[model samples]
Target: MANETMLQAFEWYLPADGHHWRRLQEEIPIFQKLGLTKVWLPPAFKGTGPNDVGYGVYDLFDLGEFDQNGTVLTKYGSKEDYLSLIQSLKEAGIMPLADVVLNHKASGDSKESFSVLRMDPANRQSPLSEPFEIEAWTAFTFPGRRDTYNDFKWHWYHFTGVDYDAKHDESGIYLILGDNKGWADQERIDNENGNFDYLMYDDLDFKHPEVVSHLKDWAKWFLDTSQAAGFRLDAVKHIDSEFMAEFIRYIRSDINPDFYVFGEYWKNDAAMTQDYLEQIDQSFSLVDVVLHMNFYDAGQKGSQFNLSAVLDGSLMQASPDLAVTFVDNHDSQRGQALESTVEEWFKPLAYALILLRQQGLPCIFYGDYYGISGDFAQQDFRELLDKLTFLRQHYVYGEQNDYFDHPNCIAWTCLGNEEHPDGLAVLLSNGDKGWKKINMGTLNQGKVFIDYLGNSTDEVTIGQDGWAEFPVEAGSVSAWVDRDSLVN
Candidate 1:
């Protein structure tokens, strides 16, 4: 089977001109040429406003289809434009994964009176104040939608918590006071920021049968209407784990078994992500946040960082098959909330590590591939990204060998499989210029390998023992391949 690669088709600072869907459609041929097997489009829903980045979700059912939320189309485009993008991706043999934001709902239709207990932001498990009555925007009737697809109306009782109190003109984590409304079981989510269940706006109560039923029904409707091949679940850590596991199962068994789901667990600790993986029963893959942090650490440390331990304690190292590895993402952008950057000089090395490796499926960021807006646009990695993807699609297959013993340098090789006789070798250095003797196996014996990256002009010939020393520039990456063995 061919390798699977994903492209995050949008960025945080994309133009809010309601042309993203159309722009993405225009890039289908480029995506195919770059060997992208899947594309994770931004959330197709209506958020707090037309320009909202889709995280401040206002309506799960409003996928730029309804006239609500002060606009008929989302930041991307109209519902018709979104469906057309999906169809175009399918026709191009690329899978479309919709961004699913189920953690909370924002900008309700109306405010309603409700009893609540204020909780400490530091310790969500501890109540800070006695029961008090407050008004909140918990009533979501979606007036513009008006009983079109599903007539499910959301009420205060359908949620567990809210962040603002219209009555008191204050903002705090207010736990809903009712028969069975509370934060999810403390054991079911991350312990950060106390309970971690109340992440903003109106937090949905997954324990509520009606709430559960409505969300599930909405997902089915979304899948059917959008014709997307899978979903990229946002903020899985804040959502109830039991409900998430069930949600993954429902969509796969009920709609399509081949349906893929990539989750954003957003935990820098591999063990914490692993805990969620076990909770979900390994039903889907997760974006490897731990690995992203690893890249950040190495970039900051430079030669001082141990290249041998670059992959250590990362989700990609622990669970490669279930890991969706990436170098940077929307949240990690310069000014984003979760801002953590891998130094610009080290980005090429980072891409090579993820794209050239065989363990985990890789995802390329739009900002890096197509360039971001504003001053950041000048920071381009397009040329290197294109070259790496080309190498990944053509070579970098079959039996793999690792040479990660050095503290400042590491390398690997791929012995060609029967069909693809042009396997490649990759070497990266965090310190000074380095070279390593890698074994390419007897199949590659006597083959003359040259650096595909053009960083080195040396054409090293493999001896009868199938071993040759490949060189890499200081603080850079290089890929080597048998130029004569190429099919073209």
Candidate 2:
């Protein structure tokens, strides 16, 4: 059966008190209530000291035990907690996708890390330091600081919190100027050569045999023991494209062949995002944001573009199976001054756009579905998620689409195990408040039609154009319109 609406829980927001393991126990209820199909946990391994983001990793192993407070006792959580969480999610029929940070490791501007790596010259050029390498034009520091060639003598790059430096073993300093101190620490690495500059963030030296072995082992444990369904690779652009391809191949072949892998390419342009899709097993589904942006802009500007154009052209341009469609994520908020798609009525519309669309797997954010009032309060968010999960479970799961595009609307005609195509035809207003009449296209006239959320319906009148006019609250979406296909 087509599964229920796919939901992804953002790991960074998962409530944790001290460490990751402790928090995992506390977060089970939250995950269950959120109606998430998948729980995306932060990196479960040990990380550089005092960092909770989990990107600044220290060891691929070291999934530690929980503390007394029921929070993630360690940097994120322990292996036992991961096993428990995965089992819990499975019991609830939700899959677990481990967020893997394979790009780099903890080593930022700090004395302790250099001490850990055990580099020499303590203050100056550590025997392990390598010169930063990049194009001359690309400036390392934003406000035009002196080049490392002149200022320090070493070269490097940083991502999340991990640093990348060539010409050094595991024991070297990684120089990064801009980093979250809470998560990353910096150190000096020689940069007589300028190879690291052109690389995004810090491209880890994947050529090392040890680097390759470590990643393979990591994948083996996650797949063989924990039974993780997929992976969300962090910072793909920061790593060499070939490295990513090889990593994906390792996971797919060695691990479960059915396992899914999506990467964070982070390029805003669809074309740019597409460039990396060919390299990874499954690229991050980014088309929903594009559609959302188009609809949002049309609404705000009162333009002629509508949902149909988005479905027919823009969204299809990218491979749908690969795109991870979402309206708002960790970075984008609804109703923000920059790109506000978060209107009261439009919530369902956006969901429908994803779940009903015949493209990449549909994944919903935690807050958007349940209608969390704010970013805080786990209790409130859980309540909202439970209620909305019904729609996802009942209407979305196991539905196939015969057609998902529309001329003036976004249509996702879904069919369950049954043969007939039956689902929603969505119409969203571009900032207009008045009721707009819309044609049913190939839908039957006078068929019973209802808005799932509002629970209202009107009979289709044929001579008058087999349409109905309903008030469209501005900045919102009429996400679903239920009816059967019309007879030719």
Per-model RMSD to reference: 1.2, 10.9
Backbone steric clashes in candidate 2, count = 54
Residue 368 of candidate 1: its Cα lDDT? Answer: 90
RMSD over all Cα atoms, model 2:
10.9
Q: Candidate 1: where is the Cα deviation over 4 Å?
A: 375-378
Backbone-clash count (model 1): 0
Name the top TM-score candidate.
1
Indicate which candidate wins on lDDT: 1
Question: Which ranges in model 2 have alpha carbons more than 4 Å from their true place?
Answer: 11-15, 18-37, 49-51, 66-72, 75-77, 107-203, 280-317, 333-348, 369-422, 434-445, 455-473, 479-488
Question: What do the candidate models score in CA lDDT, each in turn?
Answer: 0.90, 0.48
- Per-residue alpha-carbon lDDT of candidate 1 for residues 326-433, written as tens digits (9 for 90 to 100): 999899988888989778988999999899988899999998998787855537688898899998887878888889999999998887677777779999999999
Residue range 1-488, candidate 2, lDDT tens digits: 44434555542454444444554556667656645566666666545443455665544444544221122344554567668877777777777887777766543232222211222324322334343432211112311222311222112322212233333433233443332211111111112232221222333445445456656766786577778888877766555666567777777777677776666554445554555455444434433445556545554444355544554334434677666666554444543323444443344555556654556666666556444444532222333334345444444533443332433333343433353334444444444443455554344345555554453344333223445543444444443445343221
